[model samples]
Target chain A: MESDKDNASLLGGKLSVINVGLDKFATELADHDVPVVHLDWKPPAGGDPKLAALLSKMGT
Target chain B: MDIIEKANEEAIRRMLGAEPVLINVVPAREIVPNLQDKMILHAGPPIEWDRMCGPMQGAIAGITVFEGWANDLNQAFTMAASGDIAFDANHHHDAVGPMTGMTTVSQPMLVVENKTTGNRAYCAINEGLGKVMRFGGNDAEVLNRLAWIRDVLGPAMGKALRDMGGIELKPLIARGLSMGDEMHQRNVACSGLVLRAIAAAMAKTSDDGTELSEALAFISANDQFHLNIAMAMGKAIMDPVRDIDGSSIVTAMSRNGTDFGIRVSGTGDEWFTAPVEMPEGLYFAGYTEADANPDMGDSTIVETIGLGGFAMGASPAVAGFVGAGAASEAANYTHRMSEICATENPEWTIPSMDYLGVPTGIDVRLVVDSGIAPTINTGIAHREPGIGQVGAGVVRAPMACFEQAVRRLAEKLGIS
Candidate 1:
């Protein structure tokens, strides 16, 4: 779960997504001079075990 | 001068030589190169519509009624099939028309001419949205509006145009290009400029206060009323370069809600065609996707030669209708379109283009070589009978049609 501060930071104003890996996953339109509302994907509960395991393997 | 000579002369001067001309708008029957398979001499016309959208059929029905050729829809279709009425394209005769581009013999149209080069261009008058013929809603009220345009608006505009000598559309398009307008969807600044220019004429030459008031009111009311002028400007700009020997530049693009078609310079006046699809976007309050028709209209000529959907970043409102993307998609569309064009509009420069000219002259060879056909921003009509404008969206011109046209033209030029 996102804290109110983090949610506000993402929602209330612009958040320039950092790093190429995340940028590739997210919509590439954020960098333009024009503004388009951004959509994000969040895992459920503690996190999806499958996704967590996959990420851990990638990190290794 | 003969219409063909006039058209060819005008087309070359403005398009190839890069000059401006006063475009002359006329009915398709009056100017077509040939009349084969035509229904009524319509603007950018002669669309045979078994494949047409439901709304287009409605407009054709209204046109039949307007012309006193038939009392009802069945009768109109029967008469059309029996070949009693002539159908023809406006561009086929050296003119252009708007959506549902029906031009009857009686309806007067705008005639923009370039005196220096003897080139001319044309377009029919605007039909205000709800229940209007252009949006493909046909009724008694629609016929009445057409009548009013014929009896009052057309003559009044012609008189005003004559009184003002000639309105230089280039300046307005140039200015609009800078102010977030690609001379297509968002024409606020240019439209306002046209109204103001016409208003000045209305102020000077009219003793009939109400007539002048009505004209001014009408012009001020519709944001897109200047689309006619832009069409005229586009014609003036592109008509000159047609039939330039081996040149591959495109001079025209128009759709009949059933099919989208284009004409390239190398092929003279031949139209290459493909099936049209509905634009992919949002709708006005009460409309839906089914309410929309496949993309239709002469407005595509704005982009065919560049400066409408090709320059979308210049018009944000268009993005709302055609799906959303940021400035780059819009800019990239312009840049991509540049790959297919031969030149840029010296006068109509897009601000987002980093002050570069609006891409001019669509080239079929480049389109085939690069694999990116132009995109259009358009209105969709209901697919079924009686429902009008459901939504608006964006769509691409099919690449197959361009490839076919290029193959044929290449064969003709021996470049294949």
Candidate 2:
């Protein structure tokens, strides 16, 4: 339990980034050795109901 | 690692230590060394007359008329075609200019010097907005404005600047950055600050009250009057970093309408070039993207020293000028650019970024590895000569240029 707490403190929890603009900001963070998850942002329907339904069915 | 580390440190140190002062305004022939009869200075990497773009050709024709070498455009063209004129890149003479970027001997230029290093750079006074020779407007009105700047405005400014001892720009740039100016696309704050700095001296130097007030009023109303001074300042700051062996930091970036080019610190005088790209943004009435010339100018020197697009986050007001209106969008451009930079400039900080400094010292390797190019906010000239500016927008340096710089640096350092 102490080790788990120490590990959590050491890592400082996951720091995620949603880069909706240029991909480089995330890349810079990554280059600095920070773990960053890039969120692929798109409008809810992808402007197409049929395509969004297909994506949802594929469990995306 | 040692060589690159040392060079990068030296580059950054000189860039940060730079204190550009607007010391004088003088005829280009008087200050620009080696400027002789029939010689013209143009922007970007060097090129031949045959390959010169339309606006450049127009500026040349207009300058010829202004110089009394030719009576009109037709005569100028004849002389140009017959090889009676000589042209050289402005970079060769330690100068930078906006669109069409013509600096002939008789033209007056604002002289900026880095007081710390004794290095200097020159740029023509900004001929604010429409129907100007810089954008290839060759009408009598254009020539008239140029003459007024040369005969009246330039002399008054020279006297005022000399009387005031000189105006330092770095502090104004820092203050302007804090107050809605990125010092390129938006210089309204800096212009006002510069006016306040020199107004008393300007008033004192003028022969009459009317002349003084007119000159002051012209600068007051023209928001872009500070741009050429800023370009000169950028050139002054970046010059000491040039030719630093093994450093990958970009020192100069410029474009002719035909080509885009950059000079890396380690690469010395060699230029890495790619075809120019058209800018994407808001156009003036009756003009569209089709009207824009490929991005052309030495104004990118602003971005080279970490202002303009690199400092976009600090000036959300300019976002609308480049299609993005949101403050978040502005911050995103700056944040994205940080990835390709060696370090954040310690001096120039952005208010929106929680006062984090703007990114400085563009690293070629990071640019290539991330496939991200440096962004520039610029005025788009009309594709044809003599049409002047059609709009303002954002553009990116070509990736190929960065890739080439990286390849050359690798070869120079004997690395794979």
Candidate 3:
């Protein structure tokens, strides 16, 4: 019962979030008065798996 | 740092340390090496006459007539089709030019020397605005203006530069950045600066008072007068950065009407190219997207060393002109570019970004990792030849070019 109350208190407190990949999630969270940071991330090597593997080999 | 990182650092170091100076203005035949008779040097990578887009074809015909190879445009077109004219990329001859970028033996060329490395590069003089050959307008009037530039302006400026002992471009470009000139689509500030640097010398050197006034008026009236000089400066600075082993940093980026091309430091002279993209932005009155041609020019050299769109934060006026949204959004472009570039240019900093340096030395690996291509600020020409500039705007270098470059670079370094 005490643990459940603690969980509820944690959920009720101010929330901050880090959004990766798509920025829409960050925008939505910020609209709800939440603090959020968005990272401009993309799949490496232009989403080409072979190129990504090559990039890894090159240690980029 | 690893081998690639160390090589790239060296490349950027050489690029940043370069000091390009405007040395002289002379005819293409006089200064540019291996420029043969009946040969025409054009922008972008090597392209055949049949593959050339409208503006290039139009410019070629105009230049043929200007060189007296043909009597009329129709004859010039037939000759161009007949294979009498030898065509080569300006880059092959240690030179560069703007849109259509046509340079025959007769036309005057601006020479810029990298003072530190003792290397030099060349570009043709910019014919001020509308109905000019650079935009592929060929008529009696265009030919007349070419003649005047060849006879009066070129000699006058050449004499002036020689008398004044050459203008240092680094400080001038720094001042231009502080002002609103991006040295690509917007060069108003640098144009005035060039005039200020050379006007007195031109006055003292010219024998004819009428010729001096006409040349001065032309320089003052043309807002992009310094663009060709800036291009030559870029070429001079970047040439020494080429051929550094293991460096994946892009040394050059250019576009013909049909294709865009880039050269990496590790890859040397080999060009990785893709189909060129059309620019999307605000158009002139009565012109729309329907009339715009694919982006074309050798001017992207500015971006290779970090200016133009990479320095967009410096010119909010260019932002609105190119339809890049509001003034506040300009710095965002620069910020985004920083993710793909190897480093920031300490000397060419943008004031609006708290004096943050312009992003410099494009790294192909970073571009593939981030999926952000270099943004280019450019003027849009008409789809059909002879119509001249229809608008100005921004476009991104194709991702495929960068991908191909990275793949080639990896193969070259034995990573594959």
Q: Which docking category, incorrect, acceptable, medium or high, applies to candidate 3? A: medium
Residues B205-256 of candidate 1 have per-residue lDDT tens digits of: 7767887788778778877777767776677667767776655567788887
Q: Write the per-residue lDDT of candidate 3 for residues A1-60, one digit (tens) a residue.
A: 579889888799888888999999999999998999999788888689999887787667
Residue-by-residue lDDT tens digits, candidate 3, B112-168: 999999999999888988778888888888899999999999999999999999999
lDDT of 2 by residue, B71-152 (tens): 9999998898789999888998999999789999888899999999998999999999877888888889899989988988
Q: What's the CA error at residue B377 for candidate 1, in Å?
A: 1.7
Q: By the DockQ metric, which is better: model 1 or model 3?
A: 3
lDDT of 2 by residue, A1-60 (tens): 579888887679666555664578889989887777775344533244543343233222
Q: Which of candidates 2 and 3 is the stronger one according to TM-score?
A: 3
What is the DockQ score of candidate 3, to 2 decimals? 0.53
For candidate 3, the share of real interface contacts preserved is 0.68
Isolated chain B TM-score per model: 0.88, 0.98, 0.99
Q: For this target, which candidate reaches the highest DockQ against the unseen true structure?
A: 3
For residue A18, what is the lDDT in candidate 2? 56
Kindly give the stretch of ten consecutive residues in candidate 2 chain B with the minimal lDDT sum. B363-372
| Stronger candidate by lDDT (1 vs 3) | 3
